[model samples]
Every structure is written in C-alpha cells, then in structure tokens.
Target: MRNYWVRIALGALVIFTVGMVARALINRGIGGVRGVVEGSGPLSIPLAFIPFRLGGDKLGTLERVTFERTAPQSVSSVRLEVKLSDSLLARGLEGCRLAANLDSKDGHRRLSESTFWCAPAGSDTALVEYGQAVFRPGEVSVPLYLPQDLIDELQDLNFDGDSTPISEAEIDSLEASTELSVDSAPVLRARMGDSLRAEGMRRADSAKGVPSRMADSTRSR
Candidate 1:
C-alpha cells in the first residue's frame, strides 16, 4: 500500500511537469518583442515565469505592460506589477520594459503598461493609458502610453488637420474592428464601443507619434 501511494504521487508530478513544459514552449511568443529590453528588478533573483509582448505602431503606444514579480510561483496566470523607466519615456518606447499576467501561450490577455516621452526638454508631463477587455468568459486590461496633444489633434475633426480618417459624417460609428488596435498592443485589437459621439465629435487621446501625422495628413488646421 505504501509503495502504491508513492507511485501515484510521482505520476502526478510528472504530468504536471509535462504540462508546464508545453506551456512554456507555446508561450515563446513573448520573445516577439524584438526591439524591447526588459529586466527583472522587482522580480525575485530568478523569475519563475514572465511573459510580455513588445513593439509598437506608428504612434508608439507600448505594445506591452510592466508588473512586479512576486518572487516565484508555479504555472498559472498572474499580474506582475512593475515600474516604467525614464529612459523609455524619453527614448520614445521603441525599446523598453515589459511585464504581463497570463498563462502559457494562447493564454488570455490581461494587464499591461509602458512609458513614453511627453515633450523634448523641460517637459516632464507624461501620459499613461490603461485598457481592459471583458471577453464573454473573462475580462483583461492592457497597459498603454500615448501623447495627449496628439490624440486630441488627430481623433477630433476640429483638431484633426488631416483627412485619412473620418471627417464629414456625424461619426455614426466610432468603434474598432479586430484588425485595428489603434491604441493598444500589436497582438491584441481593440473594440471601442459606441460612446465617443459628442456634440461635434469629441477629440480622442492620440498616441505619441500619431497626432502630428494627423495634422500632417491635413493642410494644417
């Protein structure tokens, strides 16, 4: 009887280990963040597991997030809290820190964060944006960083000195499709529900390198 129990325990351990290995292998996508550089400062000396995606679009919104590593843990999904660096903010987030809270590959998307520059010099003003997705089964939020002035200038027809996007109509539709992650991670697309309609079309919060383009798109309004 004693030997039987021992064998059962070992079997369970083996199964668990195999599953964990599979998970890691599938999640290698974390490395897709080719241009970013991340370090485990808040995490334990050795990380049990950390997954985050990097890279940005035209505006540079931090295709990822940052979180603190709670020493270590077994295989599972969790939110790792972390801090943003001044360099990322100044350098324009082309490369920076990344943190995430999710299981293995094909895992659900959760919280994320990053930092970006506000202005050139004497400009300490920075903006941070956070988003969440309430899937049919669960809800998740991704961290984001964008320029305030830029968002306003491009998203709004009045501020929008360009013409690539909506302009004349009443903005009857203000939502996003799966292919459009206008202000979030590259892997995840956003579905902005219809609520942005205002008197004339409220200005939207533009990402860092976006508003300027919007203006450029136009004749300079």
Candidate 2:
C-alpha cells in the first residue's frame, strides 16, 4: 500500500510539472505575439491583430500596418505604411493627420514620434502627403524622419554608448502606436505587436532582391 501511494504521488508531481512547463511556454508565445520584433528589421503587424478605438467606440477595421527602418545603417529614419479601412475612408480622410509614437521596451520611455498630413484625392484610391513624398494609402516608401536627440538615444541604447555603426544594431523590442486625426482629435489608434530582428531584415532584403551594402562590400573585398 505504501509503495502504491508513493507511485500515485510521483505521478501527480509529474503531471503538475508538465502542466506548469506547458503554461509557461504558452505564455511566452503569447508575449511574443503581443510584441516581439521579427528576425528581420521590419515590423509588419496585420490589421486583424491590431485593436482600433475611437473614444468609447471601436474604430473600423484596417487592412495593414508596416513599420521599417529604411537603410541598414540608418537609425534616424523609419517608414510607416498603413492601409485605411473602408469605414475609415468613408468617414473622410481629407485634411486628416496620421501620427506614430515609438516607445522603449519598458514602455516608460518615448524613443521617437512623427506625424504626416493626409490629403486624399479620391474615394477608392488617393495620394497622401507625408513630408515631400506622395504615396497611396497602402503602398509606402517615404521614410518618417526621427528627431536628432531621439536618434542619438536609440543609437546609445542599442550600442551601449559605443561608436559602433548601427548597421546591425539589435533594437530587440519597441512599441509603436498609430493614430489618425478626426475632427482635430486622434480618433483611431493601433498599437503594433513585437520586436524587430536583424535576421528578418536579411530575409526581407533577399526577398526584394536588393542586396545589402554588407553583401556588396563583401563581394568587393
């Protein structure tokens, strides 16, 4: 009887241990999905994953959201591309402004922020103005400029105050919140999920068939 009781206790302990491990793994996965950079530098969060809100109401659905650093060595600029939902467009985007806020890992620090004026020219499709660049709602190439002080802060954080070029700086994690102006107040907000990884950047570059400068330099060597 004593041996049987011991076996039962051991079985229970094993089950409990396995359950705890599985829970931890599941939580880790959830956290990653919530906000973790991909292996590449670009952070593309699907619209379906983002929650949009306008005051007490849920804003309409968006099609896509993408944020990416333009160049391998450039850390002062990033591109933000978002596809406005039909409901949002129907509400009118003329004279609206799109803004983004970038926060540090702990969400306690504001790394950088930028805003672009949106002036739609049509209903189904429109050219929006961001700085001197004009682009359609879904297609994006213009880079959002970051402040110099913030750029310095980002570089120091990634490089540990070292002068090493940030060509491959591991940003690790960042939180991006996007907003759209309605009636002069931001009515739509979406927080992007996760960190941006260097590995993913390489994959993106390869997929675009655009060789990185690192590769070009290596070939020249």
Candidate 3:
C-alpha cells in the first residue's frame, strides 16, 4: 500500500509539472503578439506586419510606439515606420499617408501629432516618383518623425516615482487618420485593430480549412 501511494504521488507531481510548463509556454507565446494598425475603406489598406531584420538577420516587429532618451535628461528625435499592404498600390491607393493623433495616458490631452509619409528606403523625400520606384508590390514603410521636445514632455508625464531612471516610454491610444495625399485632408479615420498575432493565427487556421468560431456560431443560429 505504501509503494502504491508513493507511485500515485509521483505521477501526480509529474502531471502538475507538465501542466505548469505548458501554461508558461502558452502565456509566453500570447505575450509575443505584435501591435499593428490596419486601414479601413473602399480602398482597404491593410497594414501588414513584415518582420524587420536588424543587426545581421535578427528578426523583430514594431511592437510598440516607444520614446527613448539619448542622455540622462535629454531626449533625441526618432522616426517610426508603419508597413502597408502592397495591394494598396494595385488598387490605386498610392500617395497615401497616415496622420496619427497620440493622446496622453489620462486621455484628457493630446501628447503629439504627426504624419507618416511614404519614405522609400535610402530616400529622404516622399515624392511620388521616388516612392513608386523603390516600393512597388511587396510593401512600403512610411516614416513618422517625433521631435525631441515631445519626447521630453512625454517622459515627464509617464514617469513613475521609482529609483530607476526613465530611459524609455511608450505612447498608447493612437488614433490614425488616412489621407489620400500628403498633407491633405483625411479621407478616412480609424483606430488600430487587433493584435497581429491574432490576425495571423486566424489566417493560418483558415488556410488549414478550419472554420472560424464566428462562422460556426452563425450557422447554428
């Protein structure tokens, strides 16, 4: 009886350990989801998440809108880019730009406002000729310049009462407005969508002939 009880206890311990490990792996995978913004309109400009390679083949994504301090108390200006689906070009949605309205954490004040212009790789201007020649079919990353003064102000707002110095801060709750032309009036306005991971997983499941939960529920109704 003693030997049997020992074996049962050992089996239970093994199962518990396996469950904990599996839960941790699942949470880690979920937390790795990248942030993305998808456009909505007749000329639907789906913002795709293309893996950016950095420092010799290391792959990553634009997970957040972060502001970094260059010195102890001074911040440097930084530029961020967002990738648009290549279908935009074929669908005659070229010369488009995204105007983002970043609000403060309290949602009472606007932190910074900037526009993302189609800046081709290795080019400074967002001219039609330059942008078309460089980014044709795959995707194009448009750049949004954030000034140093804006970063400094944000740091002051996002700071917590801690001993650790604030080196970086992330801006949340961005409202993106799509303009048909650079510096023109916005044609359509929309908020950023669900996580890139959720979108990718749905696509993968669809490709594998798995019916979506929504579709199944609809059929039952």
Q: Each prediction's Cα lDDT score?
A: 0.25, 0.31, 0.28
How close to the true structure is residue 203 of candidate 1, measured as C-alpha lDDT?
Answer: 28
lDDT for each residue of candidate 1 in 105-158, tens digit (9 for 90 to 100)? 223121223212212332334432322211111122333333343223212212
Whose lDDT is higher: candidate 1's or candidate 3's? 3
Candidate 3 lDDT, tens digit per residue, 21-89?
222223334342211101111111112232222211212222223223443222232333333333333
Q: Model 1: what TM-score?
A: 0.17
Give me the runs in candidate 2 sitting further than 4 Å from their true place.
Answer: 1-48, 53-58, 61-73, 87-91, 101-221
lDDT tens readout by residue for model 2, 1-221: 23322322222122211122222223334445322222235433333323222222223433333334343222323333333443223223323343323334332333222223232234212222222211234233343333344455333332122333212112111111222121233344442111112333444456566556667878999
TM-score per candidate, chains pooled: 0.17, 0.30, 0.25
Candidate 3 error regions (>4 Å)? 1-68, 81-83, 87-97, 104-139, 145-149, 152-221
Model 3 TM-score, all chains together: 0.25
Which candidate do you rate higher for lDDT, 2 or 3? 2
When summed lDDT is taken over every stretch of 10 residues in candidate 1, the lowest stretch is 131-140
In terms of TM-score, which candidate is stronger, 1 or 3? 3
TM-score top scorer? 2
